[model samples]
Target: MSITSRITGSKHTFDSVREVLAKANEEKSGDQLAGIAADSEAERIAAKDALGSLSLETLRESPVVPYEDDEVTRVIQDGVDEAAYDRLKDWTVSELREFLVDEQTREPEIARIRPGLTSEMVAAVAKLMSNMDLIQAASKMQVTARCNNTIGAEGTLSFRLQPNDPSDDVENIRHSIREGLSYGVGDAVIGINPVEDNAERTKRLLDVTKEFIETWDVPTQNCVLSHLTTQMEAVRQGGSADLLFQSLAGTEAGNEGFGIDVDLLDEAYEFGKEHCTASGPNIMYFETGQGSELSSDAHAGVDQVTLEARCYGLAKRYDPFLVNTVVGFIGPEYLYDGRQVIRAGLEDVFMGKLTGIPMGIDACYTNHIQADQNDIENLAVLLTAAGSNYFITVPMGDDTMLNYQSNSYHDASALWDIFDMGPAPEFETWLESMELMEDGRLTAHAGDPTRFLEGDR
Candidate 1:
């Protein structure tokens, strides 16, 4: 059905809910590249006006991709809490945004209404929110999860120690992990993105990371960021892993490009649950970004923001311990510059937390993108202030293997110091025991990898 909005006597009509959602988005290069973004800012505002008036029921009834045709839509529609939806379905998208940002809307209230919301609704509310609006609304809903230790606890921020080697060399990767640990990072997970995506290489990476964690008694988990199938094979072959990692997309076709389907994901999740070495529950790790669906040509004419929210909706089904958007890594085609990247980062985290999963950010950029370290650093600070569960920190903000710049190992400690936050409780205790950190600040020996050598403990 066509929806029309009149602003200042100018009437703007969108042909479908899909058109309204796409046009309402803040300027994004990917949407424009897809030939779906609004042509003018006035039209964009008009689309927002129409979207804000669209009832939750309308959005629910209007799946971006028909349920019969797409598993992603089927999963989202089937997963809704019918009882909760029944209560809030009549409310307009404007009301939903108000409910989320209302001063009285606490975590429990948000949780109560979350099941009623769909990815489109989440994206709708996000579109109407300002950057700080997104931050304020998300700060109220701190969804914590646990694998080895608790993450997303209030007054705490965690960092994933990404010790990726360009050549998939175990010893070099091991030393990078040590360096990150010495600086009091890696409380979230010591994850590696392997140069080789095969099972043997994945197994080797997992084994090396697990051995280091055991040797140092680090209160964290280990994951090799290879394909889920590869990781499953690694685990089956007796390579230890605490978490299974995969990159997810918003659509079934996008997932196909990634060589994954819901069934394969479910099988891998079950396998990780039964065989992986982590503690109780929350064993899956997922990475998403704004334009993955578009990159795979599976966006279904929807805006990147909405498709991104659907990714979180899919992730919620597995109860993942960690889910992060590699926000700026996709490059300028989807998120043109610093402003767009920052906006997407905030929007993704807000949507992820609103979906009731642990959320983090890999505030990163590629060399070809019109962004730099300063932009990524700015994003890290904003996300940290927004109470993100974690951040991805590679050594010195550069991943030679991935050829991108992310937040640095030193950036994590700097943020902790700036924001008066510490690592996960269990990890902080371990850090104190090792004298790497004291009184929530890095100690003198904090940056030395050699401190962990030769049974220094």
Candidate 2:
């Protein structure tokens, strides 16, 4: 009379679904016996005995389902449209591999599903692809193999100088630069964001940076990480800067807060070409990371990593001098923990390098996340092995102003020693000329360069 009785064909209440399933199994076992009765009793008894046995030979002889193959097909089919699914449903493994490589065919369209597709799905498809297909896709995506040698010649170390207080006077800021330069850092560029975010203060900071470069002849560039418009305003007011810096995102809306768009970025690029006096190959420095798309509510159902790659696509259009993935700087809400941070950092570097941009990693983490210096070091070593162009080196590995820890000067030194890398060619020349480097190693002056103070005497 009740729903349970109707389903079970008995007036019994199930305490849980497990009890109902157990009853159903009992009935199924009886049905199986009845079906087996069609065979001889001796045969049925032998079959039962074989199934009941735990013999190694019998277990080894049992049929094993190829669950991994089934799972890969399920994942691929799940993300594809029905029509696309139908087309691929009958494809052989060889056919699938060919489809991924056939440039003249529309097969790549099958891979262009909606953005919410999981990494597993992407990886599954990737697994089916050959190295040639992967390389072609990377090339088509405009992934770069190496960084531009304009700012830091290839294999050079670089660091950013936040200076704890952007409002610090020229002398105080000079002190920070002196310390970083003494350790053979910042050969790439000394990038700083103004605390005041005004044209006057921006110009003053640039002036101080220019003074330091001229005084030391460090053969490096400087960056002002304010809105492009602010930097342009400073330039119009007779200010100077080597690179124009901004934080960019994948989506239009995500970049709107910074008043940036592809068009605006183009305009800024042209403006920098006109105003920037640096002899570097490019003048634009853009920073990006995951979670910004979701943070701006502009993700549009796209996965964070894919959207982040889209940002790189946009960046490469301008032929940027430096592109940095500030992994873990935003916090755990997007990345969640150190494992996620490490993965994202490696992915960014791989994607960026494949996109053919001069890619770097701001291998860093916030306190709120399950990350520490060791985590950052792990990423740094991995990224270095992956051909990362540069990283952000701060004092004692802690950025007082940004409230995060990144690769330290010591870490950079270790990487140099371990990898036998040095500063960019131009910076290396200056270091050698200044006696900061001798025979491809840091001179004692690199640690205690009192030459900067000799003018006082």
Residue-level lDDT tens digits of model 2 in 303-398: 465456656656766678888999888777677677778777766765665444677879999999878888899888777665577788877888
Q: Give the best candidate by TM-score.
A: 1
Model 1: CA > 4 A from native: 455-457
- Segments in model 2 whose C-alpha atoms lie over 4 Å from true places: 1-166, 454-457
lDDT of each candidate versus the true structure: 0.92, 0.60
Worst 10 residues of 2 by lDDT: 58-67
What lDDT, from 0 to 1, does candidate 1 have? 0.92
- The numbered model that scores best in lDDT is 1
